[model samples]
Every structure is written in C-alpha cells, then in structure tokens.
Target: MAPDDIDATLGAAWHDDSPWDLLTRLCAFDDRLGGGPGERHAADLVADELDSLSLDPRIEPFGMQRWTRGHTAFSVHPSDERSREFEAVALPYSPAADLRAPLVDVGHGTPAEVEAAAVEGAIAVASTDSPAGERHTHRMEKLGHAVAAGARGFVFHNHVRGQLPPTGALQFGHEAPIPGVGVSHETGAWLREYAAEDEEASLRVDATTDDGESRNVVAKLGPESDAEVLVLAHYDSHDVGEGALDNGCGVAVALAATRLLTEFDLDSQVQVAAVGCEELGLLGSAALADSLDLDRVKAVVNVDGAGRFRNLRALTHTSEAMTAVAERVAEESGQPIATAEGPHPYSDHWPFLRRGIPALQLHSRTPGGGGEWDRGFTHTRADTRDKVDPRNLRTHAMLTALLVRDLSTTDPDRVDTDALRETLREAGAEPGMRAAEVWPPDWD
Candidate 1:
C-alpha cells in the first residue's frame, strides 16, 4: 500500500465505530477469572473474530492454579466493641482460614514496618499506598512481610478513597501463607484508629483452589517472515468488575488493529496474540513465550492497559532500541506517546522481555502524575465500559497498528541483553521479581 492509502486507512479507522462496539461487547461478559467460563467466552470471541478475518487463529490451552471465591468477611473483635462490618474481598490465591486475632496496623506493610509493629499472632493491616518517591510495593511483598512477621491474617487497605478494595494475587505459583482480605480506604482508616485503641480484629475467608485450564488466542496476518512482531493483549479479567478500563478496552484495540493491518501488505509477519489468565499472573503470555523461538521475535507491542487515557504511553522495558522505534513511530504517525525506561514484570510484555526480546507495554498516561485517575475503579465493580473513552480507544488502535508495522520491519540488532539486565537491577525490579517468584535462577 502507498503512504496515502495507509493514511486513509488509519483515518478511516479513527472514525470507525467498530472498536467501541467491540469494547462494549467484551465488557458485557461477567468475571473473566482464569479458567472460568467468562474467560473461555472471551477467548472464543477473539478466535471467532480472527477466524472471520481468515487469520486461522489457534487456541492453545494451558493449565493454571485457579482459586474459587467463597465467603469473605471482616469484623472488629471484642464481643461488645462498636465497629461496623466492613465489606471485604479475598485476595486471589489466599488460603482458607478463620482467625480472630489482634490487628496490627503496619502502615504500608513494608518489611521495616512489619518488623517494627507487633505483628506476632496479629492480623497485619497495611496501606496500599507506597511511600512518596518510593517504588510501588507489589501485593505479594506485603503478604510475605506479614507472614515473616508471624501475622496470623492480613488486610490490604486501598490508598484511594471510595469503597473500592483493590484486588490482586497475594502470591503466584503457590497459595498464600495466611488468609488475606482487601478493604476500602475508609475501612483502613477505621482499622488504624481502632488498632490504636483496641487489640484484635476478626478475619474469615473460605476459598478453594485447583489446577484448571485457560487458553491463548494466536492469529496471524500479512506475509510470513523469519522474524515476527507480536501484538500482545490479554483477554482475561478479575471477577470483581467488567474489567473494561483495565483490559477489555485493550482487547478491542488489538482487534481493531488487526482489522486495519489486514488491509495492507506487510513486510514481516504480525502475530496478534490475545492471551488469557493475566490477572492470575502473566501465565498466558509466559506459556506463549515458552512455545516460541525467542530469536524469531523482533519486538513486542503489548496493549495491556490501552484506551484508558488520551495520550498513549509505552514502557520500553529499558530497551533503548525499542524506545527509539516507539519515538520514531510516534513522530511518523503524529501521535503523542510518552516513553518510560523500566522493567515492569507485572504486565504481559515481561515474559518476552525477560528472555532478551525487545518489548513495549502500552498504557494510558495519567495527567499530573497520579492520584486516583479512573476514579480508583480498577479491579473494582466500577471499572465498566463507561470509564473508557471511545475516541481515545480509536486513536490508540490506529497508533498501535502503526507501531506494529514499524517494529516488524526493524531489525533486532540493537537489543542489548546485558544492558537490559542491568536496567532491571538498577530499576529495583529484582526484589519484586524474587518476591513474585519471577526471578530467573540463572540470573542469580
């Protein structure tokens, strides 16, 4: 296709209504927890769309440790104590336990805080907020700290206001050492004050765990080449919300890009991979990465948190080559893109990045740096379709396609494995990776 044809195609996509329509359809489904029916539906939907595009999509099944939610309740102790029963949700992979122990408020639940506070035989109540200028603490880190401090139970308090209790895994590849529950910011404040006066709080969580199956939807377009540029997006979501802003919008963006990219002939093969079980960890992406020959992968453009904001941002995972390509693409496409240099293992791109593949994770840029953007609705029930801007979704999809095209033609000569490893170390991702059990044994 000519430059004019490419421009026209992108312009047409910018005005297209299909992306938003697809977003609505994806958010219409319930709780896309890994291996659950909702996630299977999402996988089938992506496959069907790819099949319609004649992409001959393949569904690759994988097994993951799954947890089924049961009763979770939080209440203050002391038979006559005056305290309201705060609504709470169990953190994924937390084990079943019914304990009535003294609550120890450990501030941010840092290792230092857990050590300083009286956590032995107590339920540690920790804030979700990271200290100013400090890296955000991973959920598993807090739980691990509490467990090390001999805490009998754990409660993670949201930093943002509103009754949204943030949800994420306490640990990956194994069950948590203690039962964990998430409570709202208000509840956290109450716990802080109550702990100052009283001693104990009661936490009851009952959940079941098992190994279950999930899938990744892999489709391809354009001519086959020795190297492929991966367009990664995850289709699975948490059971707490529709996961629209968190990822449903991202899935729609990937599909929309697929629609536009199929219109023009491409130099290298573009593989559109919509993986499942992201919420449980980057399991689907890991499975996909394990199946591929890493040398054949040129670069990865992962839309894990796309379409949430107007300006698009990419985490280059400390790859200067990938950063250069993204900047060039943004300039060529006339799309504003913010770039960050870091290794974030929480997203889907990490599985490939960990293996020396250059990858870019696309996420929305929040203005003014931080403070409850998206109304703190991520992983909560309020993270629905209304939170996603249709115009932003359309623009992101177009730019994503442009990036894929540019990256597919780019050689992987610039990838520096040594520098990438150094960057991950300098960025302080090593501790978190070890805590999350993603640290490669060979790296040590």
Candidate 2:
C-alpha cells in the first residue's frame, strides 16, 4: 500500500463511527454475564454484523457450568436481636450460605497474609487494591487463600471510592466452597470499625449453578495460507455492570476494525474471534485453542483494552519482535503507544500464550498508574457507556486495524516456556495461579 493509500485508509478511519455505534448497541444489553440472556443477544448481534461483511461468521459452541447471581445480605451484630445491615453483592460462584463468624482483616489477602492472619473459621476481609511496590493481587487468589485458611466466608471491598460494590468470579467453571461478597469502600470502612467493636458478623448469600452453553464468534478474511493472524476480544462481561469499558469497548473496536480491514486485500488471513465466557475465566478462548490448529497461527492480537483510553497500550508481553512492530506502528501513525514488558494471564491472550504464542495484549492505558485508573470504574456498576469516549474508540479502531495489518507479516517472536515460567514466578503470579487451580503441572 502507498503512503497516500495508507493516509487515506487512516484518515477515513479516524472519522468512523462504527465502533462507537457498536459500543452503544452492546451497552444496550442489561449484562453479558457468561450464559445470561444479555450475552446470548450480544453474541447473535455480533454474528449478524460479521455476516454483513461477507465473512460467514460461525458460532463455535462450548459447554460450561454457568453461575447466576442471587440476593445477598450482610450485617454486623453488636447485641442479640439487633444488627446493622449493609449493602453488598455476592461474587460470582459463591455458594449458598447463612453464617455468623468473627470478621478478620487479612490485609491485601495475599496467601501469606491470609495464612499469617490465621483466619480459621472467621470472615476474612481483603481490599482490592495493593500497596505500592507490591505485586497486584487477584480476587480469586484471595478467595482461594481464605478458603485454604478455613475461613467460613470472604469479603472483597473496593479500594476506589464509589458506592458501587465490586464483583468478580470466585473461580472458573465451578462454585466456591464458601460464600464471597463485595462491598463499597465506605461500607468496608464501616465494617473495619464495627468489626473492632461488634466482635461478630453475619453474611448470607443465595445463588444457583447450572450447566449452559456459550460461544466464540469466528470469521476469517485474506489469503488462505497455512499461517494466519488471530484477532481476539471477548464479548462477555460480568453481571454487575453495563460492561461498556470492561469489554464492550474491545468487542466494538474489533467489529469496527473488521469493517475497515475488509476494504483492503491483505497478504495474510486474519481470524476474528469475539469470544464468550471470558469474564468467567477465558473458557471460550481456551476452547478455541483446544479445537483449532495453533501451529498454523503466525501471531495474535488480543484486544481487551483497545477503546477505553486514547493512547493504546500495546503490551508486547516481552516479545522483542512484537515490541519493534508496536514502535513502528506508533512512529508511522504519529501516535505514541506505550508498552509493558511481561506476560499476563488475566485476559483472553493467556489461552494463546500458554502454548508459546507471541501475543500483543491491547489495553487502554490511562494517564497515571495504568490499571488503577482503568479498574477504578471498570468492574463495578460505574462501568457504563459514559465512561467510554467516542474519540478513543475511533482512534483505537484505526490503530488496531493498522496493527493487525502490519502483524500479518511481522513474523513475531514466540514465547519461551522456560522464560515464561521464570517470569511468572518472579512476578508473583504462580502462587495466585496455583491458588486459582489454573497453574499447569508442566509449568512447574
């Protein structure tokens, strides 16, 4: 493609409203929680959009243990027959529970912290935020630690102050042994003070688990060679919010990019997947990898963070070749794309990365401390359509389209397993992985 042609492509892309329009359509759903009605609607809508591009999209189905949220209640008791009730929401996969136990603070809820706190038979409370210089802790890992410590219940409170109670899964594809709930920062503060004075707590959670089906929306274009590029973004989000910023942005951006890429005749095939069940722990992408020929995949561009912020966070995942390409794209587009230097297993990219695939994790990197800003609103009820800027969506749609176009022939570096093991170990990810039961025995 000539400079003028490239210029024309990007220029037209800048004003495109397809991404923003798609974002609105996606956010219109009540919630895209794994197998919920909202998710089913969103999945069919995405397939219809893909079919419009003549890509012949298919819904690759998979079975999963679906979790449905139910009513939750929590209170502190200072005396018999009287209690102070607080608002809370059950974390996904929490088992039905009606329990009273001493509330204990397991600061940050790292395995060591929970174990050292000796929270046996107590209700362990942990913050979602980590102190500076400490590796970030995941909610599932905290619940794992709490369960292992013999806690009867778990409490995850947001560090960011919003009345919004945080919600995330307790585990992938299964129910937790104990109940877990999330509360707002204010409620958490009240709990800390009341736990000191009251000496007892009561938490009740009611939920249901059942077998269900989910899918990966797949489409392909360009040359039908043995090697191809995989462009992935999940359409599923948690039941707590509109999911606009959490993943609706990524899916919308992917759809928008697909619209633009269809106009160009490329040298390599691009397989687009708007996968499901990611919010429940990447089941769709895991199923996709298990059912496909990964050896035929040349590179992967997993978009989980594309449209939330203006500047794209083109995380190279320690691949020097991928990093070089990101820099080239940044320089050519006159846009600065920031990069991080390690592999992360928290998103759809991990299913591909586990097999040594070189993947670029595209996320929205905000101005200050990267993830803190993004997560301040993402997982909670505050992650509505207003948080997503239309300007950012269009810019990402164009840049990601350009990135996928370039990655078609970059011959990106493959991750080394030994290096991946060591890096994850040093980054304090192995313990959490093990806690969540996701650590492969072979990686050890």
Candidate 3:
C-alpha cells in the first residue's frame, strides 16, 4: 500500500468516534472476578449495547468452581529475633494452611528436583526467571507439581533484570491443590541466601473459596444461521488494577465493532461475547466453548489490548483462510500486523482451540521499542485508560468488524489448517499438535 493509502485508512478509522463512547460505557461496570455481581452487571450493560444495535442477545450458562481471595496474610520471621517482619500476600486459590512450617530452599522447584529433595510439610522458595508472557504459567505449574508431591506452599522471587519488584495477586487454577505467592527479588534472594547459610525461615499462609454466579453477556446478529462467528473480550480485571488496557480496551473495541457491523447490516451472523471472570482461569470462555456446538462455529476473533496502537501483534491458532482475512483487514486498516501460530492458553481462545475451532488473538504494543513496558502493565494497577490511544482502538474495531463480516459469510471447509500451521511455525510456534482424542459416547 502507498503511504497516502495508509494514511487514508488510518484517517478513516480516526473519523469514527464510536470506539471512545464504547470505552467509556464498558469502563462504567468496574467488572472484576469471574462470577461477581460486577461481572453480571457488566454483561447486562454489554448486552443492552448490542440490543441497541438491533441484535438479539443470548445467555449461555455453565457452572464453574469459582474462587476469590479472602483475608490473605503471610509473613517471615527471622531466626535472629531482632530482625523486622517481612510481609507477603497469598496467591489466589491457595488452600488455607495456618501451620508454622520450617522453610526449605528449593531452587526453582522443578518436578524432578522436588522429587529428589522429597520436600514435604515444608514451604518451598524458588527463583522465577521473569514476569513476562507465560512465565507465571510455568511458575504456577511448578508450584502445583510441588504441592502434589506434598509441599505445603510455594514462594517466587523475581529474576527480571533492572525491574521493579513484583506485585499484585498471584493467581492459579481455582482447583489447584496448593497455595502460592510472588515476592520481591530482594526478599526472595534473602530467603534463598539465608537458607543456604543454615538459618531457619518460618512461613504461614491462609485463604478460602466461595460459591458465586459468573456470566457471559452475548449479543447475536442474524438468527437461525448454520454458521456463526464469535467475537470475544473479557471484561474482568485483576485485583489491584482497573483493567483499562489488559482487557478494558479490547472490550471497548469489540463493542465498537458490534455497532459498526450492525449499522452496515451485513448478511453473516455475528455474536459479541463480553465474557466475565476471565482473569480467574478463563471461566467465562470455558463455559461458552462447552455450551456452543463447535461444528457451527465459523471463526473466533478475540480482541485484547486493542487501545494501544504503537505496536500491533495478532496471533492465531485459526485456519489459514482466517489468518489471510485478518492480514487483509490489517492492510486495509493501515495497521502493521504481525502473525503468530499460537493457541495462547491464557486467553479466551484456548477453549475454542481445544475444540479444534479456528481462533485468533489480537493485541497492541509500544511503537519501535520492545521492552518490559509492552508486557508489564498487566495484572498491575498501572493498567488504566490513560494508557489508551483512541486511534489504535478505532483501528482495531474496524479490522475486527471486517474480519467477522468475511468469516461469517465464508464456508468452513475453505479454511486450510496445513497452510496456517506452516505460517504459524515460521512465526515461532512448534508444529501444531495432533487433533485431541475424543471420548465418552455422548461427546459432541
């Protein structure tokens, strides 16, 4: 595309002012956690917005073992007796354990290492590589493995270079068998060194779970359609943050897309899913995926971090045809689009990918610079609307609308998984996994 063409595309995006309105409306909900009233109210607001666009909304309900943090407290007592108390917060979904256990220094508690040490009834402290994409998943997995081997709880020390101390809620599977938390690099280093020197460290933790109703606010355009396209974004935020950028931006963009598509009156069927409780293990997405028929799904486009336009990254675990459609839309919108082959387990797309449905993840980044800033704001209180660039949000909304329109009208058989796989591998993904095995006589 010519420079003038690019400018025009961007200009067109900026001309539409719906994205800003949508952002303001969605942020009004203050939605957090999967099943809380905030989530339910947020869903209602999104559904109302879709209804105003002349779309009929559907609510698909499923039960999830919901979790919430309650009165978490942890502290370390020094053997010197004169040392001040070092404090820590317990991770979400951690089991309540009030025992004053003897602390054991387990270096990066991998499965094999934990087994070799036979750590039981002792708190394990390990160093984390860094807090970046998927690093938390690795740490949590290690913590779970250790808990299964009889460890009491786990603590993580930050290892990121020249970074601020790690803060915010430590989250894991709601059903995880053990408790976990993240600590400052300084504190973690102290614990490790103290253990190495044969000084005793004392640890304690407490937490609980409560029952609640989580919801997915869905709005549909076109009724009784054989093929459907689902557009998704989670409205929930982590404990300490307002979730303006982590997902509030994506939710706003999706809402804007819904408005544009409705105004255009496209023939294809579309659904906007403003999911709740995503931060708590993708509960809303998991429920929606299970409730829907995979065979009827034409495609899923998940919008996340869409309000920042400086750097754009679009990852897909969808068919080649869908990826092509995304690239074309990006081209037309005059946004730089980079593709990746991924079934990003952390996002709402995981449920669709597991069902063998085509899915995509869209994100924005800082221009030119690739540093901690691009990935750091999430889960922290720093994620707020001030970081949002309205121009970027508008571009994302336009691209999303175009992609959904095209996919909803296309045939599922035209999608090419093989080509998509090659594209993804070149983008840094391992070859796609073989289709998952199906079981149970009643499976869909």
TM-score of each candidate structure, all chains considered together: 0.96, 0.97, 0.80
Q: Model 2 clash pairs?
A: 305-363
lDDT of 1 by residue, 1-444 (tens): 899999889879868898888777778887888888989998998899899899999999998988899999888865465756889999988899988888889998776788899888999999888777767667777887788779899899988888888888787655788899899998898899888876577788999889899999998888978988989899888888998987888998889989999987689999899998888888899999999887888888899777888888888877888888889988988788888876767889878887788888888855556732233578777788888889998898988888887877778554566777677788676665675677777676
Highest lDDT, which number?
A: 2
**How many residue pairs clash per model?**
1, 1, 3
TM-score of 1: 0.96
Per-residue CA lDDT of model 2 for 1-444, tens digit only, reads 666876787788778777888888888988899988899999999999999899999999899988988789998887555888989999988988999998888878898888788589999999887756677777888988898889999999888787878998889778888999999989889777765564689999989989999988999988888789999999999888889988999998888888878876677899999999998888999999998899988788999978887789888777888888888989998897888777767788887888888888888776576463348687888889998889888888888888888988667778887898898899988988888877877776
Q: Write the per-residue lDDT of candidate 3 for residues 1-444, one digit (tens) a residue.
A: 344653455456668776776666655565465666666766777777777776777766656556655554556556766644454655556666655555667766555556776468767776665233422224554565566668777776655433333333334335456566666657777777765655544445555676667778787775558788888998877655566777878888898877666655455677779887777777788788877777878778888766666555677665566567778767776667777554445578767765567777777765665442345555544656677788778867777766677676676443354554454345433311111011111222
Each model's lDDT comes to: 0.83, 0.86, 0.64
- lDDT (Cα, 0-100) at 389 in candidate 2: 87
- For candidate 1, the lDDT comes to 0.83
